[model samples]
Target: MRRHVAEFPDARVVLNMRSGSWALKLPFLQEVVGHSLRSIYLVRDPRAWIYLMLYNSKPSLYSLKNIPQHLSLIFKDDAVREGCPSVAPEFKTIQSVLSRSEANPALVLAHLWLAHTAAVLRVNEGLPEESYLQVRFEDVVNFPQETAETIHTFLGVPLSPAALNQLLFTTSTNLYNLMYEGDISPTNINMWRQNMPRKDIRLIEDVCGGVMKRLGYTRLAS
Candidate 1:
């Protein structure tokens, strides 16, 4: 980041990183950028987050079989020494859960979510309010323009009328392909309700219910 800023002094750099990757690097990044750094934390409802993890065509790092390797990569001695909070306890929790012969994918994923979210929260707690903003994924999909405006405002950047229109056009065009039958709608917000199995819903809630409630996502499964 310092190299990038040195090379392009006037440029605004936007980094899109998963929570785990972001947490691991945040300490070093803060040292380089100091008060100039701003973070926009995008959080999704755990149910939807887990549903996508299970069904997405691409392999996920949070998969029960894959998570140990993923965690090793992030928490390796060199990486952790960069001033990142020690997630050793979370790492052990995942290792112990994964060792269970009866552990199912959904249950493993719920634990992975807890660890990753906790890692990010631990790092983010040190950031000043002006340096951090949390945006819900549902709001971005349901109200693209408003979300864009909110993001720009948080970053202290200007959102011109023409730029805003272009942003919405691009977002809609990109999102169209991800929707069922290429239909653009906010229905994706509750997509897990229709496609995820009831047992899986209950399982995710059972594991993630406390944090889910704190994030203001109501549990749908009894």
Candidate 2:
């Protein structure tokens, strides 16, 4: 941090991490930076997240036969306990859900989402209100300019007019153009509704309904 500041005093350092247990590293990071760090916690709807996971996992990783082993490896990570003591209890809960004989892929993924989200929310309780900002992924996609302004405001950073214009333009472009003309929609906030099976959707909601409701994602199934 000192080296970066010395080189670019006016610049603000930004770290992008997709880790669910990011809070575990916060105290060490704060110590290194010698100050409290502002954080933007971006959360996506679990259904959408699970859909993407399934889509990206492909034939091998997405196979029902491989799911148990794939998830077992993830949950069995030793660093989970060593890095975040608060999340240790959730390990048993997640394992119990995974161990169910009838558990399906969506159900297992939903439980994983619940465990990670709950862990982050637990850690967030200890943070200063002004230093933390939680933004829903839906809001960011549905309202890009507004979300950008909110983020800049939260970080005490200036949102330049040109930067805002660029963001607006990018949001308006077709996703295909943005990704080398591949066939994809401009917005995919609800694509899970089309791609996921009804049974999978119901299973996800069954395991994640409470948190989903709290996060303002309405359940499509009873």
Candidate 3:
């Protein structure tokens, strides 16, 4: 990442990471990112986040075997240091949660959501305030212009009218295929309600209640 950024002056790079869980476990990578790195920690309601990951791929739900293997792959990077055994006590917590994933997948997913996000929060603790921006996924989708402006300001770049319009237009146009039933809109904020079972919903809230509240998400009454 440093090498790529060094080649071009004024190049603002966005490294969109897919697996926050993997990234959270990799302290070496986080160290390499360094305190000077500017980063955005975008998160979603765990219920929705887990639903999208598990339900979106039919095969994923049926195959519990892939869960650990998929997670362990991030350790393969030579720069990532020795896996699992070397990680902090949090590694035991992750393993304990994952052990029951085969029997109660939703619970495990919710635990993972908290574990991964907590890691990011831990790493961001000492970073200069301007070096990091923690944004919510729903906000980006529901309030495009406002969110874009926040991001632009955080990056120390101008949010020109033309650029703002382009950002808003692209977000609305690039809807997730199959995952989204209609055009991009704030209405999707509650789409998880339709996809998640009540049991799973409760499990998610149980595991992620504190973090969800910390992120300003209101819990529905049981």
State which candidate has the highest lDDT: 1
- What is candidate 1's lDDT per residue for 10-79, written digit by digit as tens? 7676667645367546656766776677878888787887777776434642453475566545445533
Model 2 Cα shift for residue 192 (angstroms): 1.0
lDDT order, best first, reads: 1, 2, 3
| Winner on TM-score (1 vs 3) | 1
Worst 10 residues of 2 by lDDT: 176-185
**How many steric clashes does model 3 contain?**
0
Residue 9, candidate 2: Cα error in Å is 9.5
Indicate the residue-level lDDT of 54 in model 3: 67
- Cand. 2 Cα-lDDT: 0.70
Stretches of model 2 off by over 4 angstroms after superposition: 1-20, 27-36, 55-70, 74-87, 100-102, 176-186
Model 3 score (lDDT): 0.67
RMSD of 1: 4.3
Candidate 3 per-residue lDDT over residues 1-222, each given as its tens digit: 667645654555454466444445334444555544566778888877777656755565526446666555534442534443444344446566555645466766676678777767785576667667789978987788999999988887899999888767756774543332334556655667887788888888887898799899877676
